[model samples]
Target: MAISLSAARLAVKSPLIAQPDPSHTVWSRLEPLATSDDVSDSLQARIADPLWMLARQWQFNELQGEDAGSPISAALAVVGLPVSTLLHQQNAVDAVTLPAGAAAIEALVEHEQVLSVHPKLNAQAGQQLMRRLRAAGLPDAGQVLRAQFPAALPAPDDAVADNAGFVWHMLLDQRAIDAQALASTLKALPDRAALEAFTSGLGVAAAQVGSAADLLSHWLGWLDELALDGSAPGASPYWQPQRLEYSFALGAQGDGPPVRLQADEYADGRLDWHSFTLGAAANLPGGPSEAFDVPPKDAPPPRPPLPTTARYPGMPADRYWEFEDGRVNFGMLGAAKSDLTRLAVLEYALVFSNDWFTLPLTLPTNALYRVSQFDVRDNFGITLTIPPAGWNMFEMSLQPGAPVARLDNALYLCPALNTLEGPPLEHVLLVRDEMANLVWGIEKRVQGASGEAIDRKFESTRLSTNQTLRPSADAPANGALLQYTLQTPVAANWVPFLPVRKEGATPANWAIQLQRGVVTHYYQVTASRLADPVNLRYSAFIERLRSNRFVETTGVQGAVDNQLQGFMFHPRGSLLRLDPNAPVASDFLRVEEEEVPRDGIELKRRFNYARDAQGRALLWIGRSKTTGRGEGASGLKFDVVTRGKV
Candidate 1:
């Protein structure tokens, strides 16, 4: 969007000026028009030169809208006509200056030759006459403009002559021309050719501009600058080449490795090659040992009509499962499992794979309490590796699941059971924010063996629970093993907005989001329920607080620099300090409480306070406080928390 200077100035109460947009292509297109010498004298002479009579006739005929198939059009249509060549090759004649006084104007007015063709000058004609007179050294005109006009015109140097064709095209293509301004500027020059050239060049520049009014304004201002001894008009510095750099990886679906590529575009139009590597370089497993053929693309079959009744009696219509072709479809119904658990599993499968029934098919028994002759099999070790090449860079992103979003190879591991003796095999899927920082994760723990005591040796480093693993149809023949997946219960939807520059970072922290219109920011407060893994399982909590201690406390921390900032979109259309009209806070504390269990009995409260550092009014909450029943603080209680950045 174009920034409105008037609006901003009024809002900020400052004399704001509009800055030129660097993204425009005008400067690049006009670069070839630059010249080193003043060719106004030659151009002026060519306008009245006898040698150019034929060319002028041709141009005049074309402008008069003569017959399309006229002989003149045919003759002038040749690509390399001598008249056209000569027109470009013509050398500028000596310069001529306007005589000081009204004598020149009077002579033009009284000239019988001029009057025979035209009775009286119109407003535009009169204006042109005045400009010509002034340029030719009118006594009342300022010498400053006269001196500057010549310098601004294209010079008589080789550069100008060689690109004469381009100059001609520019002039002829101009839809509008400020005749008076051009005449005034050219008349100041001594050489008639240079004068004409200057006028034509102005026409070209004006045509390059968006509107005639703008062209006129810039032209007059340029002449004024020359009068003050300023340099000639040229492209602004904003048009200069800008260097840019980018890096990303093309990732594949279903446990596939990624291919990374990085490149830098220099200001000089040169590309600097950077690093490239395959995801397997990080020691990831390669494709499966068995040969495989990719399935040909096929249009999905039409959906079957819904059944009038549930597949089983007492079943809700929406909750019924139907098998068509090879796919089984089912919807959420409280009769089978909680809506939350069912939706979570279904959604997860939808994101990672097309088959949502894979896990549920392994359930111990169907809700119908009928045994079906179906066997559940695992896709473990079924190398679904993606090729490392043939992908576009644009497909890469800075979000978890994207190739460029993470460096952790663990995220690609498929669900599997290693040894029956060891604890249940667990796999985690994590998601990172735009900054490539891990924000959420989910843990799927596959049951190992029934009555098997989990190795508690690593209890401190893992989440533990007392709940027995639920058995599934795919459970090992030795015993009934349950497989379950859990993720954090936090409902975080934080988004980054503004970028924060950091030294030596591949991708600097960008996007400081405006969480609430009130500028309330949050960080590490609660893990996202959607993507984050269940880090502190309730079982883990029980194990840690098994001691007799009546109160227990736990806190999680990560990179201290990760933070959130709040801001208010001010009336001026810019970010303003939150509560700008309020008095400065000497010590202001803000508190927030969230109901997690959907029951008022369990709660999580967050407290944020003013942070003063390096003379900046920063807001920070390094630590968190949690108060709950028994194993922790009894009932509800306020906790003063102060710690490091999370």
Candidate 2:
């Protein structure tokens, strides 16, 4: 029956529809979500509405009420003064006024390189001068130079001549130039005119001669500038290189209490206001307070001079639509539960970026500045005055358990010393030997006579070859093959420190201190059996060579005497005390127990030189500390028997 129903099909036509006209549309409106169970569903539904952003802001508490006003302008008054005088030593034994710029400061902190006309350095300087003369058109400048300024040869036994020699020998051929003859024919050319006349007689042009004279004068001027007498009382009045401590005054009249600074505090190159500690108040006979109507004892301490006022610069502006740096992507930052610093940074960037503002204050380098007054005027016509209450971000931190009051809001613009440090000239490692239960100061590198770093390990190896002792002739034949020794010889560079109790400590609270100790190397020699075996004891068979023992002293001695040049020690705990006023200098270098750790630490001393913004050359010797390679073994053992040769 279904097949029979398949008859001829008839085609039916469908009507065509046209698109709606543009002007015929009614007003459009977004349909609200049926269910707002999820906050995100409501946000997504009304995202196209203008009031959606406002609603989100309200949800996040962005409309909270606050009584704060935006700062429009700020004015700051500051008082600044350069350091005027320096007092050296704890006893205030010497006082000297500071020189202009950084010249005198460099002389105080840096060791004098020219001990006494070092021949090598003098020759080097002379060679540089000769090159300049040659460039100015004088081919025989070296001979003319020697003839003009004859070398002053001191007597053979004179101490000053110990390291000095004829400098021309380095530049000129010894065979061609007679040093003695040149010294004998010394012409007295005191002035420039005399020098020109003398050079003209040697067939040199007058113009060349003039240029040579100028060059010589300039060379001499350079030498004068570089020749600093570090030991001079006026130059380094308060510098104590041995202890790395100094005391100085900062007022124009130098009437304030001396400010004492210890360079060994952090052993870093930079020095700031935190380095200073106010010394005992001064007791001047006729101080400024005495000039007042009130009695000297009853009058208040002198107040600093009025400060100079100026507008604050580089203040931040608060604006909601302000463009921010896109590179700092806070969304991508990963933080762990314990990373409080990261979380604080993220919160400051996202929630409080516009709430905080920064105002920059600039001060001259090497000056101490105190903010006298700070006033801020807000957009709402409210003026706020901020007092200096040691609440600044750059305020000096107070030491724990210190008796001194918190430092005032004084900022010290440390000397503009962008020092270019040379490689460490001296390196010392302070390490602990757990097996021996001793602390050792290993002098890895020391300054040689020529101001070069000498590796102590290599030097000890070279010296040990000559110190070997042959087996004694009277010893048994078997002794030559196998030797029994009481102890092995320690490395000469490994200086020992013995643990000692504090002088005034109680039995229960005694603190251990490390005192410098000496190591003695003994030699044993066997003599023939005593002629009378019955009368002589065992001591007669073996004679201990006590007089031949070499005593190695503690502390590394440098090329300079009295001055602790290129000395560095890692101090982790209380710094090692170096009291120049003590009865004995060696006794005061006692280090605290915590200063020397089992892991060990390395300290280095290097020369640093820099030019400040004022184009003043600054030079200083600074110390640096770094973590050392784990532990060290000094190879020192007591009462040991060795089968091999000693």
Residues forming the 10-long window of minimal summed lDDT in candidate 2: 565-574
lDDT (Cα, tens digit) per residue for candidate 2, span 1-646:
3432225463335332233445664323233332322333332224546587676555555565457677776776666455555544343444566765645343354443342323334444555665766687775766665555444322211112212222233333222322223322323456677767665665677667776666656665565555443442111334333323343433323334333332224345555666554333332111222111221111111432222222223222233334444455444566655667986775555555556555655445555555667787786988789777556457544433322454456565566556788877677788898888888878776544333455656544432312433333554655355666666777756767789986898988988888766555532222322333442433321221121112222342433322211111221111122432232224335666776667777767666677765776655554555666778788888877657643
Cα RMSD, each candidate: 43.4, 18.0
lDDT of model number 1: 0.24
Error of 2 at 506 (Å): 11
Kindly give the number of clashing pairs for every candidate: 42, 2
Candidate 2: residue 380 lDDT (0-100): 90
TM-score for each of the candidates: 0.13, 0.56
Q: Compared with the true structure, what per-residue lDDT tens digits does model 1 show for residues 23-54?
A: 74222111112142332332232445654765
Query: Any runs in candidate 2 off by more than 4 Å, and if so which?
Result: 1-74, 104-107, 114-122, 137-141, 144-213, 224-229, 232-266, 281-360, 376-385, 389-408, 448-450, 458-483, 499-601, 624-631, 642-646
